[model samples]
Target chain A: MSLSTVAGARLVARKDLRIEQHSRVALAQMLPFGMLVLILFAFALDPSRDVLTRATAGLFWMTVLFTSTLAVQRAFAVEVDDGALDSIRLSGISAASVFLGKVSALVIQLLVLEAVLALGVAILYNTDFGGWAMLVAVTLLSTIGMSAAGATYGVLVSRLRHSSTLLPLLLLPLLAPVLIAATKGSEVALGQEAGQSWSWVALLAVFAISYLVLGVVLYRPLLEET
Target chain B: MTTTFAPKIIGTSSPATRILGVLSIIGLIALVVFGLVISPADFELGETIRILYMHVPTVSVAYLAFIITGVGSVIYLWKRSEFWDLLAASAAEIGVLFFGLTIFNGMMWGKITWGVFWRWEPRLVTTTVLFITYIGYLVVRSIPTDTRTRGTVSAVIGIMAIVNIPITHKAVDWWRGLHQSSTIFATVDPDMRGTQLFSAYLGLTVFLVIFAWLLIHRFRVAWLSERARGIGLDEAIAARRAEGSFS
Candidate 1:
């Protein structure tokens, strides 16, 4: 008997995580690249003034957005390089399982990267911790939303030669809503603004769920084409 | 694949499209005359509001073109027809053209009205995002792939991109309103009367006809090109076969 979709998803996710843990390329390379983006933003803007502190939430989210692209690229690269994708497809796992597995793996990797970048933002930008729980919640929700969209598009473009360049062009515009909602939510969570952050969180949740369902429904056709 | 004859490009244009082409030209002349000379200047915006005739209609048609693209994409995905895919691709090219025009005109209007070339206004930001998204859609089409794969991938992107439009609009509105509450621009309401309304209507009708005309011609061109490419591929394979190459 074939594995259940949920079980297959877990199996795929575990396998991806194991590979990532062994490679460590994402941790060693992408984390510092994200940090470099944050540091460069300070210089490009005004480091001496309080602008970086004021824009910490927006800047931090931008860093995460850029870094998540790397994680997504690496996720598909591994599967494509060794022809593992074809093996996985022929293994009787549902397309939805494969999609969810890739998304989950990307999200975990991004969360780790975000943690490191968050610490960097705290130290460099001097962002005070306010409404810490809300901050974490916003981060988690937006990260899921971003990773879901990213992973879906990543697979969609993986076969193309110019996928690395094309992925961001396709993804960034689609994720504009997520970026806006997350930035606003983080602003409120950081006490920079006075308002309910839950609405933004709700929007992020809706985006995340919508893309996840879309990926599930569409992945079968997408996989067949490959 | 068996080689097929290229379809006649002009055969795609029906009598209705020819009428539309003439009507669109007439309407264009009327719009220019009415907008530049006939419509009275707004009390607040003075002459700058004239840009609205061109700006508003281009954006309206741009939205229409994109909606058509989304519809074509859905139909293509369902029916797996090359005609629908070509239609979608044609409409997207026209949509991108209109989108570019809208942004350019908006920037000009912004400079005259707000004393700046650009701002993070919700509509402007949303249009910019839409522009980038569709441009990416076009770029995806340019990738070297089989026709079916290209059609499938672009159809997926086209549909997904349209779905994001409303979300982007809402998010930008919320983001801008929250951060820039104090910088709101108060101007004449878009509700117009007399010559202003007439010119706006004229512009919209003209642009809509232009879009239809361009779409038909573009679809024909795309079909012919695909046919030519297929013939070329068949010839290449025949030449290789004659050379005693066997797989």
Candidate 2:
């Protein structure tokens, strides 16, 4: 019997999970990497509590942005190899669904990284951890937006020559608005009362949705042409 | 036989070309003389601001060329005509020239005004991005064969990046308005007694004519190059066919 939408997505997600089992490619070294970033941030920034307090949110988001790029860049590499991407397309599954699965997997990876990084920053920099819920929400939304934009640019340019360099150039500019909004959102969650933190969160939500839709719609044509 | 198309600014050897060439030359002479000798020094930046007569119009012309490239890109995608593709490529090639000039002039103005040649200010950053995007367009084209796919992709990206032009112009407004954003292109009042303004318009007209002349020449060059390659391929194929027939 054919699978329902939910069933199909779950099945595809499981297949990816199974593939990841042996390789353990996804989320590999994420915790340690996030720790490395936090340690680096400590050494780079002044040791003053005042400085750390102000720079924590920016530092956290920057870490996420860079780490997430590393994560998303590999999101499709496996499927692209061994002709699995073509097979997936031929599998009568929605590209959007597959995109969602990849994004979901990435979200899981990012959430883990963020949790560890935020905890480390909190313990080290004396962050209050008062807005943990808001931190989680912003992390989720921001990751979705970045991953969607990154994945779209990734798929579009992957077949091109020098795509590794091209992807960052194209993706970074598109990701700028997201990065700005999300960092502000995190600042709000951290109880740094710059007015309109919620507004920034709202903007992140809107951006996430826009990039999601753009990725889903553009994926079909982009993949077909490739 | 291969026919090479050379880009002409005002005219070829034709009489009409000679007439337009003469007119453009006279217009340029009058504009330059009026601008340098007749235009008054500015109240604020003084003599340095005189560069605006040349700088502003060149940037505007470059923007005009890019806008046309965007239009040509859209037309190519819609019509799937090589003509439109050639047109877009030509505009981009020439657009880069004018854009480079604009950036150069901007640096000169920046040095004189801000006392620095480069800054990460919104306007400057956006202009740099625009320059990079055009250079990317040219690089995308210059890659080895497979013009069909690469050309279409470049065209789509070109049209989409037009979204950047307005955004760049408005970056200051949207984020931080800087360096006197113009509300209207016609903001110059009749009170302005600088002959440079009038002379600038004359320069604009001459440049527009040059743009058209170059477009015609570029289109012909691309078409002939394609034809010359096709002829070379055809002769090789015919020679092979004759050999096969004898064998």
Candidate 3:
């Protein structure tokens, strides 16, 4: 809430984004992986049965979920390299600022991935983006939820040697509600069902807000341990 | 500070816990006999309903275990104590065990009733998520780290994961409605009567007592292992000093 906190968060976020721009790991490697996951899902599920069209929302969200892990891992891996995280901790910025900064960086990368995957789903699955606004709303809210949860778990496991493997196991179950809501909301947005998409959006918003708050409060303890 | 090599008894069960353990064994035997032999078959389910005795109790105990773990986690985080950390770890282990059993029994029950071993029913889905979350908690605890750090990390995970239970249940239910005919498997209904009610209560009580017994023993084991690790570290440091002297 403090001006300094906001300034600190912006500072951290810019640093992360600048590092990512230089390395381009997410853009070069993770983006293609997300696209490939979409293509693979098409192959795994029969197109002749119209299953791809019907399952497009679920598949697209699955791709995003899988790729977000990579983004999160990269986000924290950057900090671990050269003891950058220790320097950040010692720099006197609040832990909440650092958490917000990491969540923001991860969310930006995930939003890009989501955009690419949306195009892939549209082209390959031929999904009719009927409720386009609802779709975008759902995507943004769910991405925030995922990124917040992902960033928290990423930090929780950052100090462990086997964090890469442990991160998904720790995160995915916690995100099950997000997946369910986003997938269902996507279905409604695609006009596949007459059910309420807004309810799902509400759930996503609640999930996102809770994690954002939790990240701020818990980040201090997590930082202390590291 | 003077360092001693003696193996200190950091944790041990009291007479109360020993008595509870014995009582739980007796109660378990009685419940099994009642559920399997003494209780009459359900008018609807026949012999398959007997699985309820085990299934219901396992899930009940699993929930209890997780609640205890959550409480232990909160206390650990607030107080920063090793005892609470060990308690949380032990409860999570038992919780995971019972959660697995809950799924296994649910699968068997589903196979008989629904002609499939698995269904995305709300309770089943939520339990599956709970199982995986706690398994992750256990995995986090397994990573080699200082006790304080490990406890802090796992405590944070424990608190966060438990908060998801209700949300998961609601979301899964909204995504797909509960199975209509699973009334028996649903929480106890008011229409239930007589021996069936008795058996269910007996099973729940027996399992709870068993959980308590297991928790006490598991906590003691964790404490002993922690002490042993500290002693090992001390000895290694002493050996390094002696080697330096020889050089």
lDDT of each: 0.86, 0.68, 0.87
Off by over 4 Å in 2: A1-22, A29-53, A93-117, A120-141, A184-217, B1-31, B69-78, B164-196, B199-210, B213-247
Give the TM-score ranking, best first.
3, 1, 2
Measured by DockQ, the strongest candidate is: 3
* Tens digit per residue, CA lDDT, model 2, B1-247: 6668574454224565556667767766776776677777766557764566666566667787788888888787678788888888888888888778767877787787778887555655656667777786776666554556765666755664564455334432223334544211222334456475676676677766666666666666777776667877897998899899999
Evaluated on CA atoms against the true complex, candidate 1 attains a DockQ of 0.76
Off by over 4 Å in 3: A1-3, B1-12, B183-185
Q: What is the alpha-carbon lDDT for the whole of candidate 1? A: 0.86
lDDT of 3 by residue, A1-226 (tens): 3348888999898999999899999889999999999888877878553899988888888888899998999899988878898999889888999999998888888998898888888899887788888988999999999999988899888889799999999999999999999999999998897797798999899889988988898889899997
In model 3, residue pairs whose N, Cα or C atoms come closer than 3 Å (at least 3 residues apart or on different chains), thus clashing, are none
- Give model 3's docking category: high
TM match of model 3 to true structure = 0.95
Candidate 3, residue A162: how far the Cα is off, in Å? 1.3
Better of 1 and 2 by lDDT: 1
Question: Better model by TM-score, 1 or 2?
Answer: 1
* Reference-based lDDT, residue B80, model 3: 94
Q: After superposition, how far is residue A226 of candidate 2 from its true place, in Å?
A: 1.4
Weakest 10 consecutive residues, lDDT, candidate 2 chain A? Answer: A1-10
